[model samples]
Target chain A: MITSLSVQWRMDEFCELAGLPAECLIEIVEQGILDPGGQAPEEWLFDAAALAIAKRAARLQRDLEIDWPGIALALSLLDELEQLRAENAMLKRRLGRFLQE
Target chain B: MLEPQGSSMDFKDYYAILGVPDSADDKAIKTAYRKLARKYHPDVSREAGAEEKFKEVAEAYEVLGNAEKRAEYDEVRRYGRAGAGFEVPPGWQRSGSFGDYAGHPGRDFSDFFEAIFGSAGRAGEAPGRGREGGRRGQDVEMELPIFLEDTLADESKKILYQVPQYDSAGRRLADIDKTLNVKIPPGVGDRERIRLKGQGAPGIGGAPNGDLYLVIRLVPHPLFDVEGHNLIITVPLAPWEAALGTKVTLPTLKGKVNLTIPANSQTGQRLRIKGRGLVSKLGTTGDLYALLKVVMPSRNDEATQQLWKQLAEQAGFDPRTEWSKRP
Candidate 1:
């Protein structure tokens, strides 16, 4: 079937795709690792970004053997580091253009 | 121990995969696996083929990490390289099967793994494979790299991926190739996931088929760098251009436009070009930023160097004045 990223998954579907339990997902949301829409679990709507973040969070938790809080902190720091690195790379590229003969 | 096929594939040495000695203890093996896993984990590393390397490492750990599996593997290895005609030796039964690279998005095990451990008993035979008396299909994931220009319009991308095939009894035969024409939504950024329902592995025993997830990866553009929806292009300028105002042709994703570099503009200064970047899902356009870079001639002749020296003496600019602010 032809599909796009406009797919917004609910709690149950998100759980299955991410291979995570409901409580763990709820805990991740509580830890600020994921911020889905709506007020409650049943009413929650997770967009494409939320699903990707959830999968990444699950991997971090599983492979690194980190707790929810730790995973949250790690995700936050990793996001910051990625942005910083991108900026650095862009600057370096610009510098190379200037320094090049 | 599982009964081997008539002709076996190359045997993967778990010890070699994990980079541990044959006589390495559990602690040593665990340490080695952890070090390699951290180095090669797909999520953590960007090294080419890191995921494949991590898969091998994880599969190795699945056996070596367990005492029973490791012992069984060791005994099997003692029988020499079972190449053409190999047997599992009578009276030994394959107990449990390994996971599909535990905790990975893609539920795929290698042919070597299947031949050695046998496919994870599907159809309620294994501990967790079955759901409601039948096994649910494995989910498939593939990376889809889209060009930076693709974010502007609703484009259709043709993708080819393989879906795992299983028989009625849940023994994996081989993967069947599936081709699809996927329509990508406009403004999908890097790392966005598109889910296609019931397009993964086929279900067995009336179970529901798995969903396929397409992970978006934005291809790097030669002329522009992405910052969210906005694009940044470094504008190269000579020393005279920075001093005196100039109009130069700048390239955007849409087309070429004339950009004005204001007089006395400093290096690294950004000039904003409104509504010249990527289109957003909400039908709004992002602005592009033109970054200024003052480049000098690599090799200066006597006349050029003399002119620069004269300009420096006349300019009387000391950039080091900021150093005096330190208390």
Candidate 2:
């Protein structure tokens, strides 16, 4: 079966795919880098987006040597910047549609 | 470029990749690596070819960061390269010590890296694959581009990708091409991924195959723009159509429908058509927003200009009165 947005992974599968330990995942969750569904680690379910972000967090930790808090802040800022850029481009395109060249 | 060159491999200059000097110390090497990594990391960098550049940088740091690897690398450099190819001299012994390295997840260790360090930390070979036996296969990740129209309905896509193959001995073999037909559910957005377990590279010794992740990218639509699940379509109207009420036919993804443009409508105003946008996975449809844009005719004949002059005199309208209260 192809898992869509509705599908999610248990902790074990998430750890396997992300190549991170449970402790690291907990640290990331505590730092607000990942907010997976459910309350406890065992009960939590990680989606594909969370998987991708978890891997990115792992990279930031491994390559940049950044602490959990630092990585969390960086991820938050980077996400906001990406959203703002996409919104800005959409707005610019909309404006262009109305205005003559 | 990292492919095995038999006894000879290209002597990739780690220093050049990091833009550092040959005699650069640990601190200098680190600073250079960090700068390049931050700039070239595909997740963050917006530049073209950032991923390829980051791989070179990361690979360079992998060897140079460790003292043992660096020493071994230096010794090999003494042999010198012959026409872009460096051959390991006879009786070359690798350093027994290996660093504790978990490379960037998707970063494939180049042929040069495997040639030097062996396949212990490369892409497919996990640490104990040979000894343990029945090793799981490598996971594959690829982007699957779908049209905007497809997101509103159940769509099936055909994918062609290559997966790494290995014999029972866990030795590297030629990759085999595979094809899969995937069904995409409605309401999928950009950057979302669909996972297919046990569909990636085949496992060795009957171990379970790895999973495949298909990241979705929505192609831009010519007529509609997506915001969340809602779609926005520009409705261009003539000056008369904007000032006076008019009925016009609008095209929707499903079909064309007649729409009424209210009198005295202004540009940039939106008219929302409910339940006409993209559908959600939970079976809810978003609204379609029709953004109004008013335009003047390209040319006016003498008779039309006279009529416009008469109307301007009679109407006596000031469109920019709000501008007078500027801060």
Candidate 3:
């Protein structure tokens, strides 16, 4: 039920939510692996969704030691898998309806 | 873009002067500069005007070294008159020459060279002037390629990294043998960098040693392709196995596991085995995804071909029916 607009987390909170170590998250930010958004009048902020993505990114870096490009590839594949799973579920639902009829 | 008014100074067209095209990127500019600099450097060249030419080349780099100033100069040159009676636009203050700014010391550009690049030079001056001490030691980067299987298992490995150490004369010495046991956590992929504390050069006067970064690279696997915590394996199934539901042995990280193929399992269908994927740091295991690849026999003798033909005829199913509807 938690949406990006409803949730706001600081650096530590964000790391904890993302299931990433605080030191690892700090390293990622320092190495430009993750952009924490710059300060400005209309500054970009890391909402809950962004924080989740950042955590996923940190996990990929920690687990795979994948560079940015490789990390991008892995994330894309995961996204595709999620999409496929949703589609499969939808198909199964439709098939169940057909069987009932 | 407004044109410059007054001060008809004959500015050197360094890009053209160096025989490099205007649209050349930084690499191209550097290449041209090196070729010209080496040829015209006072110590190297004995030709007349070689020193002047070298200074001019150095001047061009002084302006072009910076991105913002180079952009402004390029704009002005393309639109504004070079040696005509044109005054600089309003609010445009000529602060100081490039040489006065000392943008790049040791190789000083002449005063004429500094005038155009001066404004751009001023912004970067504060940081440069404030910085104390000579140049810091260059950061060293090394790549360590590991197996996907090893990463999944969180294996500790002994890695030999060659790092540059300075002698008494400050000369870069060859890579000294420094072996460290690096513990690779599960799920590491290519290009992940690991930093070693004080593993780099010995800094001067008890200064902090530069860090040694280890970039991770994953060795390619023959059968498996890792996707995050999930392990993707193309399971080759026989035609009979695909047609009829059967329990078949599958290759997994921890040896073979029997997998049930649903009736009429089609190609590209994925079967997931729960908690059989790569192990995470939190002791949670991801699912293993088995992608079905119904492999057909490439070459079959008379008996095998006849068997397949009979089986195909008995099935009475048109696999191409869906494809025919596309048109």
Candidate 4:
């Protein structure tokens, strides 16, 4: 869960890079795919992670034929799966020191 | 995305690419696509050339996965074969109209695909009311390997990577090498992605440039293992050192420090060294764990053997009692 002082992108840049409309970005924000800062769309500033998620969501829509809600769910599950796998690997490595087979 | 060069476009057998027979049904084709896509997806796979393979698969599916494009491509396919220089039959007019059915605009298809399906504006193309006169450049992503020791402090690193350049018509020209002295912030985790603004491919026309995303890959340390921000090091101790407490000099990211091994400490015991792991951009530091592992002498002399025998008799300890009780 280590994070840095991320660079932020304005709404126009976010939309341009993510290849999604403002409404779609609003929908994604509403659906919790991204948690960009600011109150309104005009003031909204996205980080690199948000842009990456948006791009992935767009790919799911274009390539996998998934809806926004479905993409959000899939991304969330995939992120959780990745975290669990990392934690599992670390735990296994730690356990291996004591339980040699 | 590498189209065969020369006047004639190479024939791309969509059916062959999907590994389906000519008579394979739509369900079978879709199943094959799904399976291959899952296997080759650049985001999921670590296989070399996976991104290229994914683009190929997506292009194949773009045609074969659709009804109209498949039928139209099928008519063209009858006159061509895979890997051979192909030309559309003279006076061959496609009966079906491809009306933007293949919709992956960001992913550019081959010239042959454009020749068959009719060329459309690339996906990244800005509409008439775009902020810039043209579309921004395509974003680039590349792996950046960082040493575990480097994560302990902020450092400047020189990085060189290639960015693809495209023309105004969205035709790939050549890759341009970009060199930058990137300021790597502290405590960057493995697989963490950082974006550099306007560091990607140059924009076409008067549009702004795209960004470059650097994915962090931590190189395996010789002595330390990374667990998130924390670090682990295996500290080897002599049997006597473990039995009777000893002060050992342990290596930290900064320098060496004294660690006190407790009396009768067992193997696999861990002692945490506070604030010695890694530093984050916010000035927060993680702790390092020293894992104890007691090692015996590799070779024993006669006098050493006699001493060991005397100690064994004096100790009278059986380590395998639990193993004997386990069924």
Candidate 5:
């Protein structure tokens, strides 16, 4: 049965979990760095995954002294590399399974 | 003979005080003295009551300084107290007894010196029995720098290092080839230490080896900087693309993705790509953010200039009207 108490989050709740101030969150939203929703800020919502990403972004800026533009480029490149690696691994696994068959 | 007022003078073993054997050569004696002198030096020491210590070291150097006095003192010590029981030696005056020797002011000797030499105020006495196997190896340290990407990728990096190795004869040799495969963990920041266990010198008598530590350093990326897992990309958009909403193809880590730019989008606008960031050990992904920059055409042809003039007259829209009203 689907329970009503299933974990869900709104944009504000996710920002709070990420330990970001409302002003910063607003700036990120206005800049389009984060999409809370397709509509206005009031209607925007985010889940736990978004909140975790936000927290990591905050730490990178605060602790690592990385600027926003640099942070974006780094994240994109690393994501690309990781995706390639994952795909390669998945293919290898599939090939091995086929061989067993 | 009239006895002196003070107590009898005690003998001192100067060779033992300098950490040298009785049969030590001149070179060994000088080396030992230099070491002790540095330890008890006044200028650099912060040890408690070190001023008194300096004076004691000075006094030890004085008697050991003169060869004639050292020889006589050594003879008196070797004879033992029983040898001096009845007859005073030739050239030695009985007029000045051991009690008279105490009348001279005591040097600022430490209790360590006093334990060996306070009773025997004279130098060159062989104090205690000899101790064996006395030498120890020196400790060493080094620093290393590593790339930030290498650390984040958890790659095994081989580092060439030179460490001091001792031969079986205990001679220190240089340029030891110690190749270390450092396993870098993801998220390792600059100046973090990766300790290589049991990689240092083999201790005496097969004791556990010392540790070699590698300090991590991240090389700065030309195009990107890592802040946790998120990546930032500054993309230049055409003026028309910014003015009117359009679907633009953007390069992401995975592949090209179609991104929508809202109408009237301003420069410095940012867009986020979800789950498109650095992969972490926790099986979680970060994000990729793109900042928009509007680039205007530097040179316009006569036809383009005429088209803009016509559009301005027809539209009658002033972009700066809001700014003028701000006062």
Candidate 6:
């Protein structure tokens, strides 16, 4: 089946892929690092984006020695920075189209 | 960092991997590790082979990060040099022992590390070891580049990658070559990673295989720029065409379509072509934006210059009025 963005992994599989325990995933969810679809962990479904985010959170905890709260704050800031950069580039391209001599 | 010479194990240059001098203090080593880890960590960096680079850095820090381990490694490092594999002295054995595993998941230390630390606690001890109690294999990740057109429909892609194999004792073995045919569902975005279960390295003693993660990278298109599912194409227009609107044939992803440029259309004007963009996984097609760009003739003849001069004088339009105003 063509299931790229729509593919959702159950909690156990997500934990295995991310190399974290269920408690860690819960901490991440509680800290707002990821929001899997369902309300309960057993019924929760995590998409590809959540997988990437979970992995990043784990790395920050292990590599940089950052705590969960610190990682959550850093991730939100980094995401914001990426969004601003994309918007800035688009705006520059649009302005260049008109300002060209 | 280490290259095997003959029967002897190759000596690794941990200093070179972490880009630090032998005299670097603990604080300096930690700083370098943090900087490189941030740069090469696969989760954050889009650079090619960043994950491998990160592993090398991590291994270096694992040895140098601890004071006792660094002292022991330094003694052996004095007898060895990078790229020139030397046999261990007949009676020489390093004094430091491998620290108890802190349960770092999915990380495998290099063979050189095992040679130095004397493989007390190695790969096979991971949580999901083989079905017979050996650790599961390591996961592998690679980037997959796809064309914009390829994302329009479901397609099968053939990929070839190397998977690390291990002996029954969890000793590192030569990498095994593997090929797979995977179906890429439509609407994958740039940098999105898809996980394939049991597609990574084979586990020792029939343990569950590791997963293979494919990170999608969208190749830059020749004609279009992607914003979400929307496509933007810049259309060049002659001065007269911009002054007096004209219909022109434009190229779409599938075929050519006639686009009517409205009269007095200025540069930077955008015309939206509905349902001509990429199809999302939700089955919704986005709109295509045709951005207008007015261009002047490369070489203006005397006659053309005279005609332009007359029009410029007659129109009496101040193009720099906004710039001329004192804000």
Tens-digit lDDT track for model 6 on B114-200? 767765534424545434565567778889999888888877889999998867765556788998887887887777787787788
Complex DockQ per candidate? 0.46, 0.50, 0.04, 0.30, 0.01, 0.42
TM-score of chain B of 2: 0.88
Q: Candidate 2 lDDT, tens digit per residue, B62-144?
A: 88887877887777666765357776668866664543344444456667776677655444325223235676677778999
Ranking by lDDT: 6, 2, 4, 1, 3, 5
Docking quality tier of candidate 1? acceptable
DockQ of 4: 0.30
Error of 1 at B211 (Å): 3.3
In model 2, the number of clashes is 1
**Whose DockQ is higher: candidate 1's or candidate 2's?**
2
lDDT of 3 by residue, B48-90 (tens): 9987777777778656656656776776576445465333445
Candidate 1 C-alpha RMSD relative to the actual structure: 4.9
Residue-pair clash count for candidate 3: 14
iRMSD values, candidates in order? 4.1, 3.0, 20.3, 5.7, 25.6, 3.6
Question: Which stretch of 10 consecutive residues in model 1 chain B shows the poorest summed lDDT?
Answer: B121-130
What is the TM-score of chain A, computed separately for every candidate? 0.89, 0.91, 0.59, 0.87, 0.68, 0.90
Query: In the order shown, what is each candidate's alpha-carbon RMSD?
Result: 4.9, 2.9, 16.3, 3.7, 25.4, 3.6
lDDT of each: 0.77, 0.80, 0.60, 0.79, 0.53, 0.80
Residue-wise lDDT of candidate 1 within B1-327, one digit each (tens)? Answer: 123455545667788988888999999988998789778887778799998888888778877888877887887777645344445546656666543423333334555655556655212242124456665676678899999888788788889999877777556567888988888888887767788888888777777787788988888788898877889898889989999979999999878999999999988899999999888778898989999988777799999999999999999998888998887
lDDT of 3 by residue, A1-101 (tens): 11012345566545533445566656555555456676531333445345545645654453233676666666666667756865575456433422424
Docking class of 4: acceptable
Q: Which candidate ranks first by DockQ, i.e. highest?
A: 2
DockQ-derived CAPRI band for the predicted complex in model 3: incorrect
Q: After superposition, how far is residue B127 of candidate 6 from its true place, in Å?
A: 5.3
Of candidates 5 and 2, the better by DockQ: 2
TM-score: model 2 vs. ground truth? 0.90
- The candidate maximizing TM-score is 2
- Candidate order by TM-score, decreasing, is 2, 4, 6, 1, 3, 5
